[model samples]
Target: MPWEKQFDIDEVLEKAMTAFWHRGYTATSMQDLVECTGVNRASLYATYGGKRDLFIAALKAYDESGRQALFAKLEALDDPKEAIHRLFWPMRPWHPGLVSCVAVS
Candidate 1:
């Protein structure tokens, strides 16, 4: 029988995205995605093809979300500098909930 996924894909992608964001593409393992997203290996493989494909999906999702957020902020601001500030202000290294993919010096 084909395994049915009983979870939200966005939620899984967010978890998987965070995992990939926290750990780089190379360092992140299939088991790690399974643990973080609550999606089993078989389901992940079934849905996203594999870790690489899943990572690509997660990355595309991340970009889309980030782009939308930035655009919304920029649309509200008249000044370029302020818009730039608004765009980048929330992003910071070691944010309370964010994990770095690579160590920053």
Candidate 2:
């Protein structure tokens, strides 16, 4: 039955990564990951060796992706101040996306 369970690891990782990134480690439940990734609990446990391991992997993946994106912008801008400004410029928009993760401040 091993071959029958042909789930894509990358897709699952990406889904899990988004869930973790959005909700953070302390708030994200195992059920949340299962729902987000569209995989059963057992499959998730077996594939990634529980929530912590999966979260670690997902964080690494996300960090690598963010680093690459920042590197590209830095290369294009050349100026450190401009690069920093460019990196944070997109976040200045009044989007509801960051509201969920923001604490009362």
Candidate 3:
């Protein structure tokens, strides 16, 4: 039979995603994931199949979140240039932080 735990998978993944997003895959340790997700190491390993797999999942989640956020922001604006600027400009300063999660190797 399947068992249930205190952790919410989506919520945990969201946090893990953010952590991996802010810190690169090679930089984020299992301890970091436990601390960020409030879930233990065993759970992380069992569910995500170690750090690499978890990071890949997190990166996918982060990318989906980014695309959704961008779509929403772009849809809200009437001017295409302004929308593009708003979506892309803030990236310059935080590019490293946001783009680092995409590393799956």
- Best-performing candidate as measured by TM-score: 1
Top lDDT model: 1
List residue ranges in candidate 2 displaced over 4 A: 1-5, 77-105
lDDT of 2 by residue, 41-92 (tens): 9988887799999998887877888899888868897688887677666775
For model 3, name the residue pairs that clash: none
How many steric clashes does model 2 contain?
0
Model 3: CA > 4 A from native: 21-23, 77-105
Poorest lDDT segment (10 consecutive residues) of candidate 1: 96-105
TM per prediction: 0.68, 0.60, 0.62
Error of 1 at 66 (Å): 0.5
- Give the range of the ten consecutive residues with the poorest summed lDDT in model 3: 96-105
How far does residue 4 in candidate 2 sit from its true spot (Å)? 7.0
Q: How much lDDT does candidate 2 score?
A: 0.83
Instruction: Give the per-residue lDDT of model 1 (tens digit) for 1-100.
Output: 8666798998998999999888888999999999998877988998999999999998888899998987987998889888866655577644765544
